[model samples]
Target chain A: MSKVVKIFHGPQHPGITGNMSVELDLIGETIVKARTHVGYLHRAFEKLVERRTAMQAFTIVCRICVPEPDPNEENFARAIEEITGLEVPERAKWIRVLVLELSRLAAYHLWMGGQAGSTGLYTVPQWSVGYRDYILDLFEELTGGRVYHMYIIPGGVRRDLPDGFLDRVSDVMDLIESKLPEFDRLFFDNAVFKKRAIGTAVIDPETAIERGVVGPPLRACGIASDVRRDDPYEIYDKLDFDVITEKGGDVYARALVRRREMEQSIKIIRQIIKYIPDGPYRTKIPYPMNWKLKAGETYVKTESARGEFGYYMVTDGSEYIRRMNVRGPAYVHGVSLLEDMLEGAQLADVAMIMNSLGTCPPEIER
Target chain B: MCTDNPGVWEYIANWARKHSIWVLAYGTGCGAIEMPPTMTSRYDAERFGLRGAATPRQADLLIISGYLATKTLKRVIRTYEQMYDPKYVLALGSCTINGGMYWDSYNTIKKLDLYIPVDVYVAGCMPRPEAIIEGIIALQKRIEEGRAEGAKKYRENIEWYKKNQREVFGDEMLPDYTWNFEGGI
Candidate 1:
């Protein structure tokens, strides 16, 4: 007979990243019930957006998802474009794809670091984060900031790619591609990582579909439901790359999906570099402060590194937005699916399982 | 083996303080992004003995990285309470000091020290990895000099801190919607 023991794992656990907690009811090392505790990092971002001007809200939207912030900017830009009936220049579209894919690469690198770190494979974090900094350096050159690029605006991006920007990006991609084999040796092909990650936190295809898992976690279960492929946005349809998927639906499968996706991201970036048209990167909006969007609502979804990142914007012919709802991947991954998946899993696997889902607390808290 | 040295315990504690500074990774906002780079090999914070701890109970330092909304402040205060004595608070980024870009924003507190005792303030909108290392070094100096008594003083005046925390988080032990003021931008 098993006795139930309760443990509060976070709002501060190393396994659980960011400001969130999980109340675990355990029978020995195996977990019986896991309840997620949020509100630790809750800033009421959706409500905060309702009060700010449309342009001011642009800065705030990036805070919704820290790891894949570009999607929020892209969503805001697209929604505003739909409302104002603005046409994104062909060059800007390609540039948007460039930014998005670069963001995807950066995000995937960070995810790989976190997932590996959670499983006690410390070297993966060391290598991946160091590599990811090269991407951040590019961001610092392209935008002004490393993490919050606030460069994507309503009409278009803030500015065109700088002189020799493409070369810099290509060089970074080259370096990242070259480093992949070493990462494989250190992490992917390593026996310890393979042994711990394989078959752990298995979410069968049926369960994944039932839980509405999106992005790599969903694709890891062998569903090729990439928003970029199915519902083409920007230049994704034109750009050729395979949507990587795996059938295992475990921690290892998720890691494999992300690893393959990084390669795919590199391919996408190469396409953007080769075919980027020479034109204006941004279309002028009248003036951000005085600009009033026409009365309309648009729901735009983009595949971010973590999963399907979507924004629903409702404008009421005013300077301020009427309603803005952020549907982050964490809602499905962290809250709904996390609770169900933790059942019967060993206590030690909690962090690994959570990291595999790629739960961004800001995304969920927003 | 030195019987004459009465300050040997202090010497050992000082040396341990330089190497084994356990960090409470209290991520508050956007500046939290810079932490991974510092912790990773590029900056390698572990060389100086800065390791991220899960619970505040075992941590010797609390790194409040980035902005703190009124909602986040409540939990931060609670976490601070749980930390053991001889702990030091390191405030990273300008946002943690004077709210940086969000200074005008209603939700974010203007001064972090108004709520909690901060020993070191790392000034940058988002400080560079080098700046973070400098902050840690400065903190180590303070610890060695015995000037890092803010945590002890905070424990002594716990009620005052709790009161300040309640003003933001409210009288309830945990934050509720009433504490959330959805003022206009």
Candidate 2:
């Protein structure tokens, strides 16, 4: 007779992303049940926002998702714009798109690094992390900070683009595009990676939608439901680009979707570089401390690398936000979906499954 | 006749000591982004015998990169306790020292050394790769001179460390929802 064995894969396990624990019931290496444990990195971000003014919350929003923080800023700004009926300058819209696409590129690069590392492919982390730094260099040149770029604010961005900014961005894009083939050689096309990744952690299209998987993970299931396309915001409606999708919905499929999406992000960046209008990048708002927003609420959503990152903001005609709730994709995918998907998989596939789903704990905790 | 087996075992032991220095990548905040590049080929921290180990039991160095919130401080303490003796702590970034930009913020801890003993402090919002390499070398020098033993002494004074941590964090250690805001550092 076989007996059930309980195993705790931690807030520190390599199989788990960020600081989160998952309790698994296993018979040998095959898992029978999975339960997610949060509160490990819970920082009370929502309550903290409630205490700060709307403008002050701008700085805190970026901490919601460290790898892809721009969407939080974008959502916060857009919600405020919607509440006050503030008109953002056309040029500012283009700049917002540029920041978002760059963020997407950076996030995809990070995901590629983590995904490769999960499978014992060490060289990919080396190649992708080095390539990711070029993007960080561009961010430093554009926004003064590398990781927490508090650049995207309400009304518009914090400052205007510096001289030859577009030219420098284009140069970085060219370098990133040039290195894609080498990444292909190292991880994407390598036979060992293919053997381990393909058909592991399979997610059917029906299961994906039911479980609320979003971003590349959803796209990998062959559903082309990008908020940038379907619920068009910024200049995404005006831009022309294909929504890359795959049918497999496995770890390999998620990797393929992100890989194809990187090229699309490059294409989007090229479009922004070619067509950015000549005008001011920001529209000044009233003094942030004394700013009184109209009494209303708005739900703003953006296509972050993880998925449909949305923020619902409510104001009571006061400086302090009445309620600000974040709907990070990780809450649903990492907690609910991951718990269901891990059951019956081999122990070795746990990390691959978590990576494919893009389980960021900070986002979930927030 | 007296020089036949002249300390060959000692030579091999010294060589092994010089070649392997496993690091526990105890990332506490945003500065973790810089860690990948250092560990990767751009700087190749591995050439200096710095490889990221999953468990603290096998590691020789603990790199506390970026900020440590009151929430993260508890885990860092637990991880430090779990690590074997003769371990060194390298606090990376300004946030880990005096809290940097987050100094005025409520959630982040002002000083990491107040909770656990830190050997070398690498100063920068996020220190550049060159600075990190320099920090590793500085730590190696300290190790050669037996500076890491100080950390072991601090650990031996376990009650003192716990009292200081409680004094800093207060009722935040409890799992109550109200304690989240009231007892924040």
Candidate 3:
């Protein structure tokens, strides 16, 4: 008879993407059953948002997911815009696209580090995290905050681009692009990484779709669906870029999708730099001190680095928000999908699978 | 509690402890993101002898990086207690002090000091890597000066801390020392 032992994987584990735990009933090195638990990072954001004004609520929403916070801000801002029928300026749209793409690049870099780290590759995180810091530097210059921008608001961005900000951004882009070949040589095309990731955590395309997997994880399964292309938001419709996909739904496929998406994001950023119009960055809204909204409900979704980040907001003609619900991809990917994938998986591959899925616990619990 | 004062060996110990602090790599919140950069080449926290320890047993520092939900509070205390003696607690972000942005949230604790004795608090919605480095320097100074007695204080005032911890985690009581020796295989 095979003896089974139950062990808790996280809540403070290094391999865990955030504050989450996976209970694994294991026999030897093979996992028999897995259950994901997440309440550690819960700040009751949905309930907290109800107590604040729209502007104040914007500040808090970004804290939902730390790695790629702009998506939450983007969703919240767009939801309010949709509800109020507010039309953002053309330049603002371009800037929003730029912010979104830069955010995607940053998240991908962080993910690269996590993926590599999970596989016992330390050089990748050391290099990738350093590179990510440059993007954070740009974010600091633009929004006055490194991690949480809170720059994207209902009407438009909070402020205009600083002098030569585009030039600085281009410099960082140039540096990152130059290092891609080195990264490919070291991580993507490396024999060790390929051996570890290629066939691991293989997801069926049909299962991916039925399971509502979006973004690179879904695209990695050969479905050429992207929120930017399928449901165009901001100036994504006007931009020119392809929705990248891979036939293999394993960790390797997802890595390739993200790597190619990085190149695509770079292309999109260059386009924004060239085509951005000269105009007001934001439209002045009426006094925020006592800002009131008409009774309404709206849902807005954006392609965050993880997957789809959607916000469902309701207002009852009051200054305070009536209800706000965040539907982060991690909610699905971290709990249900993680549990499904971890079954029968070797205990050692659990962190690798979790990292590839990009599970952010704060978003799940919030 | 039985130690002597101002000995030459104590100074040597303080200096050695100040130079080598193994920080447990347990990221409690948003402030966790900043740690990667701080430890990496750009900020290089390792240069200051601040390195990531995989478990509590080997760590000398416990950094509560952001807001702590009640659920996490239980685990943090457990992890804190698990660390070896002569430990320090460094609280980061405004969330640790007066609850910062999550002050009104139902689950997040208001003041971190009430639950755990914090040695240093770095103020920011989420403090930058530079500020974090500065906080580390301050902590190092405190260690050298032998003023960082948070763990000692925790041990001395066990009843007060236990009372506060009980208030936060009502019925879900935690074991005093988690590692049980009596439970045999």
Candidate 4:
């Protein structure tokens, strides 16, 4: 008989992406079976959203995915707009595009740190996290809240861009671009990272698609499928950028996809800054607290930094939302894909593999 | 060499504990995202002796970053018990204070202090890094003054804490992992 021990890898471990855990049964250092355990971070967002009106629901939706929250807000707003037939202003669309891209950039910066940190590179986290502060500073100036910017709402963004906001965004973009070479030296191009990531937890392209993997992880499998490219949302059709992809579906390939995508996001941001038209940022809605939505159900999806974030809203012609369901990419990545990938992998590579998938536990448990 | 007053020894011990606080990098909720900035270069929580610990046994500061659902609370309680004496629990976000945003949620506990003793509470939907740093500074002050005796308080009223914890967790409560049952926390 073999002695197999079960170890819980999270809900507290620094290696874990969020407040989630992986239960691994190990015979020595090799994992025999892996089970992903969530619910640690679940705040019952769907239930809470149903109890609140569309305007009130907007605030809580962003908390569904903490790391990249703007996409949830965007999806919520777009879904409500689609249901009520509210036309968003032209400039508001561009501003939404800018916010999404900036959120993507900030998220990727943090992911770069996580990917590097998982591989035992301390310098990358220090550098990348420090750099991400500039993006957060820009957010603070624009939205009035660094983390949870409840700016994007049903009618439009809460307010117009602050004075010189675009210029500051441009400066931050330039600063990030300038630091790319140093980032490559410390993280992307580092030999040790490549060696550690190249063959670990490789996913078959066919399985990845069947498993419903989206965003960089899917693109890393040589299948260039992006929500922005396929189903145009916001002003993405007008924006000039490429859907970056890589061949192998390993950690390195995912990192490479994210790295290239960061450049694409920067390019998109630059275009927005140069070409943004001045117009009324928001269209007025009736008294928000008492504003009733028509009876309808619609689903809206946005390409968040992690993957496709979709929200399904059902309004029963009532002031309070009838039902709202969040469809986060983490459901596939954090639970099913994570369990599928962790089997038979080395214990040391658990965190590395999890980070590669970019699983957010709040989204999973929410 | 051994002829030293206990009061002097306590002073030195508290001073050492005040600095070099090893926080459990657990990320209990959404507020966890802010931790990266606070601990990393920008806020540099390390300058004030706050660094991350890999496990509960090695940690002195437990930062419950956001709202604690019942499931997470079970583990948090276990982790809290596993920690050595003089542990400090810094409840981050308004959720922990009184379920700030998720006030009506079925899952999230209203008051974090009910389950685990909190030393400091950084209030915000998700408090910024500056607020987090301020909380840490305040915690250090409490430690230096020998006022941050949450662990001792926990031991003194383990029954009350466990009762509150059990009310939420029910029969599926964590197995007792108490290290010192005779005279220590």
Candidate 2 off by > 4 Å: B1-20, B69-72, B93-95, B98-110, B123-131, B166-185
- Cα error, candidate 3, residue B40 (Å): 0.7
TM-score order of candidates, top first: 3, 4, 1, 2
Candidate 3 per-residue lDDT, tens place, B1-185, comes to 11238577878888989889999989998899888889887899889999999999999999999999988999999998888777899999999899898888889999999988899999998999999989999999998888888877877787798899999888887886453335310
The order of the candidates by DockQ, greatest first, is 4, 3, 1, 2
CA displacement after TM-score superposition, residue A61 of candidate 1 (Å): 1.3
Model 4 chain A weakest lDDT span, ten residues long: A150-159
lDDT of 2 by residue, A97-150 (tens): 998899889888888888888888887888888888888888888898777788
Instruction: Report the lDDT tens digits of candidate 4 across residue range B1-185.
Output: 11134477777888898888999988888889999999898889889988889989999989998898988888888899898876899999999999988999999999999888899999998898999999988998988777887877787788898888788888987887573467656
Q: How would you class the docking of model 3? A: high
- Over the stretch A5-119, how does candidate 3's per-residue lDDT look in tens digits? 9999987788888788999999999999999998999899988888898888988889998899999989999988887778899889899989999999999999999899999
- State the DockQ of every prediction: 0.36, 0.29, 0.82, 0.88
| Residue B181 of model 1, lDDT score | 38
Model 1 agreement with the true structure over A1-366: per-residue lDDT tens digits? 599999998766667767778899999999999999876555667777777887888887887777778999998888889888998888989888888989998988888888888878888889999999999999989998888889888777888899999999999999999999898898888898889889888888888888889998999999988999988988887989998899899999999899988999999999889998888877877787788779988889999988888888898998888998888888889997999889989999988898889888888877
A1-366 per-residue lDDT for model 4 (tens digits): 589999989878889898888999999899989999889888888888888887888888889888888998899999999999998998999999999999999999999989899999999999999999999899999898898899888777889998888889999999999999899888989999989999888888999889999989999999989999999998899988999989988899999999999899999999999999989899988788789898999988999988888888899999988888888998999898888899889999998998889898888879
Every candidate's lDDT: 0.83, 0.82, 0.89, 0.89
Q: After superposition, how far is residue B43 of candidate 1 from its true place, in Å?
A: 1.3
Can you tell me the DockQ of model 2?
A: 0.29
Model 3 bad stretches (over 4 Å): B1-4, B179-185
TM-score of each model's B chain? 0.84, 0.81, 0.93, 0.93
